[model samples]
Target: MAKDYQGEEILVVRRSLFDELGEFQGINADVDAYLPSLLNPENNFFMDRGAAEDDPSHKQLIPYCIFRVKDDQGTRYLHYTRGKSGGESRLHAQVSIGIGGHINPVDQREDHLGFDTYMAGVEREIDEELNIEGGHTNKIVALLNDDSNTVGQVHLGVVHMIDLENDDVAANEDAIANLAFTTLEELRGELYDRLETWTRCCVDVIEEL
Candidate 1:
């Protein structure tokens, strides 16, 4: 069964206020600088998607990452499949370079401060989707948004780039499958139509040759 988290509260901020931070219209971002402003828990808080869904003004913050693998064969990126029973219906069969979800109320505990604490959900999502055999490094790169569309209207994507020390990452659940590693060109051409909106818009983050 698809994970129905409709009523569960998730963190978000008004787009007008989020926009005050600066231009986050598409993919232009500097994580170190942009992130600090968003860390203010007061500016953001939890609200059920059931109520926020139709309200594009309320942009649900989502932590997203693109896992990269570099080996003797060169560089490759991970793209996973969304099983039919996946929580997100619009993403089924849509190959995506990004992996992540929303922040919950429990995740906002006052004690857990700083970067690691803020990215706790991002770490959790990465571990749940890919099994890493070696040490991995990740960094926030850009902020992605597309308020033009419905999904884009309701969600804001904080994009990160993660590079693995080794090439031993694989799918950890049925919800994620087709663990394929492909070059930027390969992905851009082959998975062109299949790429999700966020991935398609933020491809450059993972398109490194």
Candidate 2:
């Protein structure tokens, strides 16, 4: 079943054993294992038709993206949150990439016009998270989709560095605790250990950029 995400909650899903094992073998194996399942025509995961009537698990998966911004001084800033998820209470701020949530049925129809459905979701997510008005000016470096790591398929929309200094962008308090720009070294040394898969993917994408 699709999980409900209240404005107050943050969901972090993990990769499957197949994903973890494939990481050591090669990227292709990992990609093949996860991607085909999602893109297969026989599978209802990517189809827009009303297969929900036949298969109860036919609900569309939520699509999301991650953004990595850098400043003139070469300091990279990632969006993050810090708080208690359950019984654990630690005053730690998790540094992660910036992006936003799923493409709702309404968003799929109205917000994204010319782009691919998934690309549209990425564009919408960036706009919603950063309060930006249009597609990112930076070049899209990579498009990654990994379902093994999440309950819903995760699409990593990697873009070239963005200059957030002049922009009026700020984190939504209800969704995050604090958002700041930190160095890559800091992210790897201090924050990576505590990060979720989505956050780890952001770091990986940024390193390639």
Candidate 3:
């Protein structure tokens, strides 16, 4: 049992079919048992736990994105931070996506019921990076485990339309380089390859909305 940085007890819930069905409407059964099947390498629907744990390169934090699409123009924008793309040159660049990070020791509490720890991580990350006061209520569009890829766990969050035009909702310069909007078409065409499973899941949710 891996202890959280804050010396808190951590629980690793096995992937289950019930968890999957619970994410969507309708369809009820003993779904909890099926979570492992979805994560199996042979199925490839999601990543296997072995791969996620074996990889040493991945930072253990769960990353999330907060994206929005304009009602009139239908253009979507993602928030991201600027970081060093480790390579020979050690060059730094900007990435387009919203804020999210790993689960803190405070997040893995028994008192915090109903809400998932991953959701709590996203909420904390958004406030830290964007300096905005909000929460993870009904904003989560999809959840994904990225064991198949180099990046670790990821969750996609879709916030409902709000007055983003207000200048007060600005991103922290210390955390992010810039924030801007982009179209879904642009995301699919230019940015799709760079996206993680959570990004794809968010697209699915956006399609329905």
Number of the top lDDT candidate: 1
**Candidate 1 C-alpha lDDT tens digits along 1-209:** 43456588877877777778775567866666567766666567678867776688788888878888888989888887778766677678888888888776656554343355568867777777778899988788888887767778888888888888977878878888787788888777878888888888877545431
TM-score, model 3 to reference? 0.51
lDDT of 2 at 69: 48
Show how many residue pairs clash in every candidate, following the order shown. Answer: 0, 2, 10
Q: Candidate 2: where is the Cα deviation over 4 Å?
A: 1-70, 82-94, 109-120, 132-138, 145-168
Q: Please identify model 3 stretches exceeding 4 Å from their true place.
A: 1-63, 69-72, 85-98, 108-120, 133-138, 153-168, 173-175, 193-201
How do the residues 109-132 of candidate 3 rate in per-residue lDDT, one tens digit apiece?
343422354456556666676754
Candidate with the larger TM-score of 2 and 3:
2
Could you tell me every candidate's TM-score relative to the true structure? 0.88, 0.53, 0.51
* Candidates sorted by lDDT, best first: 1, 2, 3
Model 1 is weakest, by summed lDDT over 10 consecutive residues, at 108-117
Winner on lDDT (1 vs 2): 1
Instruction: Identify the runs in model 1 with alpha carbons over 4 angstroms from their true place.
Output: 1-6, 111-116, 205-209
